[model samples]
Target: MRFTSHTTSADGITERDFVHDGVPGVLWTPGHDPAGLVLSAHGGGRHKRAPGILARAHRCAAAGLAVVALDAPGHGDRVRTAEDERFAIEIRSRMAAGQDAGALVAEYNALQASRAIPEWRSVLDALPALGDRVGFWGVSMGSALGIPLVAAEPRVRAAVFGLIGATGPLVRAAAAITVPVRFLLQCDDRLVARDAGLALFDAFAAPRKSLHANPGGHGDVPEHELAGAVTFLAG
Candidate 1:
C-alpha cells in the first residue's frame, strides 16, 4: 500500500491517498490513536470523494475515528466498461419511464458487490493499522455492496446502511449480517421502492438494529441525519 499523496488539513486531520493492487482509496486520520475505523462506500454515480462521503469521513476523523473510502467498481478511478455504461443508460431510461427498475438495479449491484467485497477484504488485509473495532458506512449502491461485505467480514462491528432493497442475492446476504446496524430509510425514495427497503430492514439478522426513517425522497437525507450517522459510526 504505497501512499500517492499525504496532506494535513488546518484542523489537524491528515488525508492520505493510496492504491493497493490497483484499488484507489483515501484515508482520513485524526493524527491521534484512533478508537475505531470506518470503511465507507459510495452510491452509484458517486466516487470515493463525493461530498456526502467526504463529509462523513471528515466528521468521523474529527471524532478520533480513522475513516477510509474506496471507489466501487466502475466508479471513481476504476475503468468503466461498456456494460457499466449501458447499465447507467438503462437506469435513467427506466426511471424516466416510471418503471420498476429495482430488479435491474439489484442485479447490477450484485455483480458489482462480487468484485467490491473481495476488494474491501483486501483493503483490510493491506491496512492492519485501521484498528480492531471496525464499522461500515454505505448508501444506495454502497449499501447493496456493503450488506454482503458486513455479512462476510467479522471485522466489521457495526454498520450504517440502507437505501437499497432485498431484490437479488442480497435477500440471502442480509440474513447473515448480525452486526449492529443503523439503517437509514427515506420515506419517499424515488430510486428505491419503499416496501423493498422496509423489507430489507426486516431481513437483517442483527441482534441490535434500528430503522431511521426520514420524510423525503431519495438523495434528500437531511444534514442533521448525517450528523446522527457520524455519531452512530463513532460509537
Candidate 2:
C-alpha cells in the first residue's frame, strides 16, 4: 500500500489515504496501540469515505481499533464501466416502478464480489501485522461483497453483515463462514424482504451468531445499534 496523505485529528486519531494496486482506500488508527483491525465496507452508491463509513471509522478508532475502508469496484475513484452504468439504471428503474429488482441486484452483486473479494484479500496481504483478530463491517452492497470475503479469507475472525438478503451465491458463501457473526436486519426494509434477511441470518455456519432486528427502513438503523457495533468489534 502506498500512502498518499497523512493527517491527525485533534482527538488523536491518524488518518491515512492510500492506494493499493490502483484501489484507493483510507486507514484510521488511534494514537495508542490498537485493539484490533476492522475492515469496513460501504453500502451501495457510497464510497470508502461515505458519511456512514467515516463515522464508523472514527468510532472504531476511538475505541482503539484500527479501521480501513476501500472503494469497491466501480465505486469511489474507480472508473465505472458501461455494464456498471447499465445495471445502475436498470435497478433504479425497477425500484421506481415498484418492481422487484432482486434478480438484477443479485447478479450485479456477484460480479462486484468477484472483483472486490480479491481486492480485499490483496489489501490484507499488503498491510502489515493484521494478526488473527481482523473483523469485517458492511451492510447492503457491503454485505453482498463482504459475505464472500469473510467466507474466503481465513484472516477475518469476525464480521457484522446486514441490509441484504439471502440470494444468489450469497447463501452458499454464508454457509462457508465459521467466524462469529453479528447480523442486523431492518424489519421494514423496502429493498430487502424481511424473510430473505432472516433466511440469510439462518444460513450462517458460525456457531456463535446473533441477529439484531429493528423496526425501521434500510437506512434507519438506530444510533444505539451503532454504539453496540463499536463495542462488539472493539473486543
Candidate 3:
C-alpha cells in the first residue's frame, strides 16, 4: 500500500490514508499497542469515509483494535466505467419498480466481489502486520461482500455482518463460514426481506452465531446495537 498522509484524531487515534493498486483506504490505530486488526467495508454508494463506517472504526480503535477500511469497486476514488454507471441505473430502476431485485443485486454484488474480495486480500497482504487475530465489520452492501470474504479468509477470526438477504451463491458461501458471527437484522427492512435475511443467517455453518434483530427500516439500527457489535469484535 502507498502511504499518502496521516493525521491524529482528537481521541488519540491515528488515521492513515493510503492506496493499494489504485484502491483508496484508511487505517485507524489507537495510541498504544493494538489488540488486533479489523477490516471494515462501506455500503453501496458510500466510500471508505462513510460516517457509520468511520464511527465503527473509531469505536474499535478506542478499544485498542486497529481498523482498516477500503473503498469498494466503483466507489470512492476508484475509476468508474460506463458499465458501472449502467449498473447503477439499473439498480435504481429495479428498486423503483418495487421488484425483487435480489437477482440483479446479487449479480452486481458478485461482480463487485470479483474485484473487491481480491482487493481486500491484497490489502491484507500489503499492509504492515498489526496483529495475528483479525476481525471483519460490514453492513448492507458491505455485508454482501464480506460474507464471502470471511468464509474464504481464515485470518478473519470473527465477523459482525448482515442487513442484506441471501443472494446468488452467498448461500453456499455462508455455509462455509465457521467463524463466530454477530448477525444483525431489521424486521421492517424496506430493501431486504426479513425472511430472506433470516434464511442467510440460518445458513451460517458456525456453531456460535447470534442474530440481533430490531424493529425498524434498513438504516434504523440503534446505537446500543452497534456497541454490542464493538464488544463482540473486541472480545
Candidate 4:
C-alpha cells in the first residue's frame, strides 16, 4: 500500500545516515534549529514513514522544532540483511513466535532489555547539538525509547508521548524525569489502552502535565497535544 506524504515545510526533509558510537540509523530532519531537537522512534512493525510519522515531524519542524525520526535497527532503512535474506531468516523465526500485538510487545520488551536506550544516549553523545533544548515526541516504541533517555539526560526540556502512557519500561523510568510532559489518547484504542496511559500519567512526578483524549481511534493524534507541549517546554 502506498502512503501519502508531502514536503511543504520551509525546511524540507533531509535523509542521511548518522552513525555514532557504533549505532547507525537513518535521520529525517524536518528543518528547524539544530540545537533544539525532537527524536522519534516508531511503533513495532513500523518505520519512520509509518502513517503519521513524517508529516507530524514536518509540522513540528514548521512549528520551530527540529525533528529527528529514526528507524529501529531492523525496520525501514535499518533492516539488517537484504530484504530477501533478512526476512527469510528473522521473519520466519520471529513469526513462529506469534505475529501480533503480543509479539510486538515482546519485541519491544527485548529491545529495552538489550539496552536500546543507552544506544540513543550514545547518539546524543555523538551529536553534541542533539543534546540541547531537546523535547521528545515518540509514538509507541518511540515513547519507550524517549522515557529513559529523557530521564537519564537533563537536556530534554519537555516531551509529548503519542499513543503511549505511564506503563511499560518507558513509564517505569518516567519518575526519573523532572521535566514537563504530555500524553495523547484515543478512548477506543487498542494499541496502547487509554486506561494504561492514565495510570502512567498519574505516576509521573512532573509538577505540570496532563492527558488529552482525541476524538479518534488509535494512531496519530492531532495538534492540541503539540500546543500543550509548547506551553510546557516554553515555561
The best candidate by lDDT is 2
Off by over 4 Å in 3: none
Model 3 lDDT-worst window of ten: 124-133
Per-residue CA lDDT of candidate 4, range 45-126, in tens? 6776776676666555556555656666566765454543543456457657655344445354446435566766666565
On TM-score, the leading prediction is 2
Q: How many residue pairs clash in each candidate?
A: 0, 0, 0, 1
Model 4: lDDT equals: 0.62
What residue runs in model 4 are displaced by over 4 Å at the alpha carbon?
1-15, 21-35, 80-107, 165-171, 223-235
lDDT by residue (tens digit), candidate 1, 1-235:
8799999999899999999888899999997888899999999899989998888899999999998899888999999989899989998899889887777788789889998999999998887887898999998999989999999999999999988876747778889998889998998887877888888999999889998999999899888888988888787
What do the candidate models score in CA lDDT, each in turn? Answer: 0.89, 0.92, 0.89, 0.62
TM-score of 3: 0.97
Candidate 4 Cα deviation (angstroms), residue 163: 2.1
* Model 4 residue pairs with clashes: 166-200
Give the per-residue lDDT digits (tens) of candidate 3, residues 75-131.
Answer: 988888787798899999988888777777777888887778998988888755788
- Measured on C-alpha atoms, candidate 1 has an lDDT of 0.89
Model 2 spans > 4 angstroms off: none
Per-residue error for 57 in candidate 1, Å, reads 0.7
